[model samples]
Target: MAQMNMIEAIRSALDVKLSQDPDVLIFGEDVGYFGGVFRCTAGLQEKHGLHRVFDTPIAEGGIVGAAVGMAAFGLRPCIEIQFADYIYPGYDQICSEAARMRYRSAGEFTSPLTIRTPVGGGIHGGQTHSQSPEALFTHIAGIKTIIPSNPYDAKGLLIKAIEDNDPVLFLEPKRLYNGPFEGDPNIPAVSWAGHELGEVPEGHYTIDFEKARLHTQGSALTIICYGTMVWVAEAAAKAAGIEADILDLRSLMPLDLDSIIKSVKKTGRCMVLHEATRTSGFGAELIAEIQEHCFYALEAPIVRVTGWDTPYPHALEWEYFPGKARVTKAITKMMEG
Candidate 1:
């Protein structure tokens, strides 16, 4: 085991994949020479040479479009979109071309590619760079959406995504890239060096993309969240003095319904949370599924703690964010009912 930050762990995953598989290719804006904006792909270009690890133009559409073609021709292309907020330019290629390649070709061709991008707020990136656009991609069919909360899951899930036979949208919470955040802006940021989740194995490993990790088990209520919100949920549960079952949904697409239902049944209440906007957020789908499977077991109406239906504000980041205070209030209200 090696203590590493989210950036180091991700770099390790890419390095391992590039070395193990000759078909794997890494490319994106500044990903080769500049080593990505977050430095997740640093040192890779030098290690693997410019051929396998290279840079691309600033056009996201062209980047994804080219990756789709590469994947169709039998190469595994892992491309970065810089930020999840900036992935709109490549939306058509990801949703139309790469996602539909296998099904459209009757299993004759598959785009085994992974699109990695930093997502979420907390760095004062304003509206453009701070949006958590997981819902946008999750709404699209034929694609798997993944978000990792810590260094361990970041490394493991990324490797799995790169190895998957279909295209995967790997969303990295930029806020949690170096340390875990639980919605408390006052808490000093701690590097992964001393964190337990930062102790990632320096090897080739994969966490099942369909599994949801249980952070804390309880019967009072169930908190279902992913990405940066996982830490927020944990802190909320503690602050609210609620014995909550916190489930970190690493993969949003092939959601671990089994685990979710089990927890909802045991807890008899559920609160779906995310950093995305509340309207039509992925939490809505989770609420629907929970109601379908465990409606009778529910003790109170399902609740959701999410961002407001407006553009992420730069000056009012904390107010715009669905933090521990909001989550705690919701949990308390649900328990009171």
Candidate 2:
């Protein structure tokens, strides 16, 4: 099997979908000529032609609004906001219009739109360029949010997001775009150990939206996370010599609680980590659910190693983001308790 970087894998997925469906189209700033800021859409315009894969103005709201309209008109439009931080400008469109179209219209209408944007820190893109805004989108009633950790999930989830009838927020981690990109392009598009399986095939695949990927097994502790944190948690487990069970929550809104409960029951101890701020983050919700369903199995209080409740800082960005050291510390603390 040949290896491809995360960016290439995403491009491959989009290429496959657009080729198979005439209704599938991509539009965003610099998406056509420059192939997007990260080049995730590189060569797409050339292959699919400008009408299907074209560029748009430098307006996030306009991009999202256009997508909503196109989706209402029976086209599957994928809009790329240059950065996750900029998505807020279009949040109203996503939450009010795109998200509620189907529910508001009682199935008479739908918004099959996908909003793709690069997120996270570690590349020094600064506060404006790096932000994990999925928590906000996930809180909304109508949209589905997904964050992928590697090349394989990135491709599968993006494809699934595009095809789904609801408006989907596809948060791509910019940090994972570069480097070794360990995913195998020819490896049958199988779901990773802790990844959700989309409806994609070996020739072309789309992972299901609601499943959780279990990466490892252990009776000690269950480390629950998504996006880049999954990889970090695994590394921390290895470094601490702890057999931590890891769960990659591929989809945020339609969370796979079955996976969470099952893991907690086995490990009897749980720790949640994420790049988002500690207060009112996804970890809090998971902790509440675990307390409700798996309280008796708890050997210790559920520890959360998350970003501090502050604006994602510039200089202290590394500290703000949860790392292996913090993860190990949390696990050790749980073990001690």
Candidate 1 clashing pairs, residues 3+ apart or interchain: none
TM-score of each: 0.99, 0.92
Q: Which regions of candidate 2 are displaced past 4 Å?
A: 180-202
Tell me the tens digit of each residue's lDDT in model 2 across 1-337: 3356677778888888998899999999999978988999999999989999999888888999999999999999988898999988798899999999999899888999999999877666667876887778878999999988777788888888988988999988877775421122222333233333222243477789888888777778899988878877887787668897899998988999999999999999899988878888888888999999999998889999887887777887667777767777777777888
* TM-score of candidate 2 on Cα atoms, chains taken together: 0.92
- Highest lDDT model number: 1
> Which candidate number has the best TM-score?
1
Give each model's whole-structure lDDT: 0.93, 0.82
As a TM-score, model 1 comes out at: 0.99
Deviation from truth (RMSD, Å), model 1? 0.8
